[model samples]
Target chain A: MENNLKKVDIIFEDSDKCAPLKVLEKTLKRTADDIILDLIDSGLKGRGGAGFPTGLKWKFTRNETSDVKYVICNADEGEPGTFKDREILDRVPEKIFTGMAICGYVVGAKEGYIYLRGEYNFLLKGLLKKLSDFNAALKKLNVDFQIYFKSGSGAYVCGEESALFESMEGKRGEPRNKPPYPTVAGYNSKPTVINNVETLVYTTMICHMGPEKFKALGTSDSRGSKVFSVSGDTPIPGIYELELGMPLHDFVNEFGDGDTKAVQVGGASGHCVPRKKFNDTIIGFEGIPTGGSMMIFNSSRSMYNVLHDYLEFFAEESCGQCTPCRVGCQQLLKGIEAVKRGERPPAYLDDLKKLTGTMKIAAKCGLGQSVGNPFNSIIDNFREEIIY
Target chain B: MSTTEALVKELVEKNGRTRNSLMPVLQGIVQQEHFLSEEALICVAKELDLSAADVYGTASFYTFLDTVPRGKNIIRVCKTITCHMKGKDEVIKAISNALKIKVGETTHDNKFTLLSANCLGWCHKGPVMLINDEVFPELTPQKALEIVEEYAKK
Candidate 1:
């Protein structure tokens, strides 16, 4: 019964992932470096929008000072059209727990925190039972690890790695300047390793499959399988795992059973590849980020309204600490309004373009840069809709 | 009622008798009692010397802490894009239909409260529902109702 495909459904398929987790209880005696090498070889990237190499991120934490290190699983997955982590937390909480333990063991950090979103408090309602079960598994495995959950205050920016760390410290969730990069200074100024919930949850699978076997599925640029939400106009819109190099035409129609106009890869921060461009686009770096969110829009949808949602999200969620993000987000919205209301001549459109460029270059952190992505992608792909 | 003199005195005493403790005092009371009733808000305002408007603003701005009494079980289905496109609206409807109540409303038994949220940041799991902080994913309408029914029995 399709043995190769891994399924860790707590509520769905009887129990596919339980095998690897059971094997982990017996194996996993090696140090953290072995796990990192296995991760690097497997070609696993962050499931969140960033798409950073999981191995490379772990390497940075490995390189950092040993004393007072931290391992935090960034469960604060607030990106639009991204529900992969919540699924892992809810359905496969044990797998996520195992991955967190492996990370803590690899990084030699005793403490781990799952920085979950506050809206997920209701999700956590039944999870304490699972957590207790996981804790019991940890003692059984003989790993000296302790993990706790810290709920997010529902700030979208807190989804950023640094911001998640700051929020865990009980401050308002806001993105901090990088260069320290959380690998160096994170979680109360300790050397920390933060992985997206999916990234960590997948480690147990890789630990069982081995890296090269895990790498066998996807493209060279983006290895292994990715989970897609595939919402919007799709008859079978739900999560499906596909290889990274899979064709968009096939991917779109795979579950998005409809006449498609465009595919918004990588959720709100990702690009809107027009239907014509679908042939050339793959879900990876050589392609756009699958970011694990594939929202297909048909003719019925308006490009303007879609772009508006992204801009509005940024405007409302900006941390308000930095000028570029705090002010530029509002300006982008105002300019959109100005254009929509016919207040600006077509020539004024040049200013909006230039301002977006300025925000990209001068903004403080990932929030500003990420905010630029949705606007940039819309202007590039949907210029015709935007211009008139 | 949050306004009983016994509870109010305990809350104010716990927060210390300072004007600055107004928000903290109300927040403390809510944490203890699980909902900030109108009487509790008034008690906090009276004890802390802050306007009721100010107290209400602090309470409502953050969505985590509730001001009104919540149902015995709260189902916060993510209305975020990942969830929405995956039939979150339908899921909400299913919950409402089963409970015979609408979103943001409680059942007559006060056993379930249904509400929608932006994103819980776990976009990987579409059509996700959080029942009091523990999320359940990939829900069909029937499965959701069954979960709600279980909670109702509790």
Candidate 2:
């Protein structure tokens, strides 16, 4: 299996061949329904941590009977351990814009926006230049759609789709009540479709290469290659597009420091798999899913410090509107501190575990629900590191 | 009226007079003034047909939009997991000791304000710091202090 490690490059293959304008020109010839059908058959999922089916999201938004629908590409890549979107934006921004334009064409929307994070303000100038070039090409091809860019003001919760819409609307970046989802009432109460930067790039690929060819890459559950931002305690710490469903042990053997003890699959909100379970863990939807953040830790690192860093991040970034998230994060962080300082009994951690489970069920959105993931996983795997 | 106020008014006019333009308008004002002043927030609120509370709520929600005054240059040290494992703590300590200020404080000379940020998205080159818009990655304690001293001279 190690000798036959299949690595595929669908999104960041090359600039000219995957050029946005060229891909758009080819994709625009297909009817809207055909494009949507191709996406549906591609078996692609949102690469922004959430494993939601990408085709279903586009289909829902396209079927909505709204005259003023909107398409947004979520470039607010604020997840602490994730940075593949940043690399993508820097290398092949045209592919992202092209993907958004294709979404606009299929979903019957004329306007699109890329809600970029504020830390990435430096990228604005170059991305705008690319957008203008894409727009000029669109005009030559007589495409009616236009794409705009919005800069987010450094809020992590705004990475949430509804909160992103709110931030784009010049309001506080907070999550909205979900029943009338983004597909029904979003971005000024119009039916909207939002895709992650990576997801949209794959959309372009599904259009360029037929869905059957695209689906032939990864396992049955997870299709296509995933661009992982591998950092922390690795010999080669950079971007890697690996076939999904690869075992964690195989991944560590290839990229690890040879002293790898554990891996944090995904960002702060993702799960932690210890070395004992590395062979059992698969890097895909069927096993331990991720948003392409693989932070490997060796024996020298302390799991206590790791958990503290993640809890602190969640405490700072939680959008405080909901009680379970706002207060629950504070309690969890404080609880971990007490445990590390020997102030709280080990039984106190059991209570904290119960609290995190409550936060998972009661919190308003994904942010609150996922804050407990790392908290529970780290505690479960490294209780010794915490107590001693 | 002050030139700054007039310039802000012009920006509000240029971006358009709508509630949706609130973020861009605030971002523009912060870029020029380094922080959002009370008068500017009120002015933005009035121009965008939002209350001052609304403007303040939105402005304070984002970490980049400072509600209070900041130093001439903002130095953000990345403290995410990768950077932490790469000895970001030592780099942060070097800057603090060199500047004679703590993590969340500004230099008395008002030249640099030190801050700890979560993942500047340069984890590949671990232990990174962003001085204003420029990223300095693969940093050590000595290199971090030298970078601070270089900025201090400026």
The models' CA-based lDDT, in order, is 0.72, 0.88
Residue B117 error for model 2, in Å? 1.0
Best by TM-score: 2
Span of ten consecutive residues with least summed lDDT in model 2 chain A: A1-10
Highest DockQ among the candidates is held by which one? 2
Angstrom error at residue A286, model 2? 0.7
Q: Write the per-residue lDDT of candidate 2 for residues A283-350, one digit (tens) a residue.
A: 99999889999998999999999999988888898899999999999998999889778899888888
What share of the reference contacts survives in each candidate? 0.41, 0.71
Show what share of the native A-B interface contacts model 2 retains. Answer: 0.71
Per-residue alpha-carbon lDDT of candidate 1 for residues A3-87, written as tens digits (9 for 90 to 100): 1233223222225544645746644677668878889988888877677898888788878776778888887777777666766
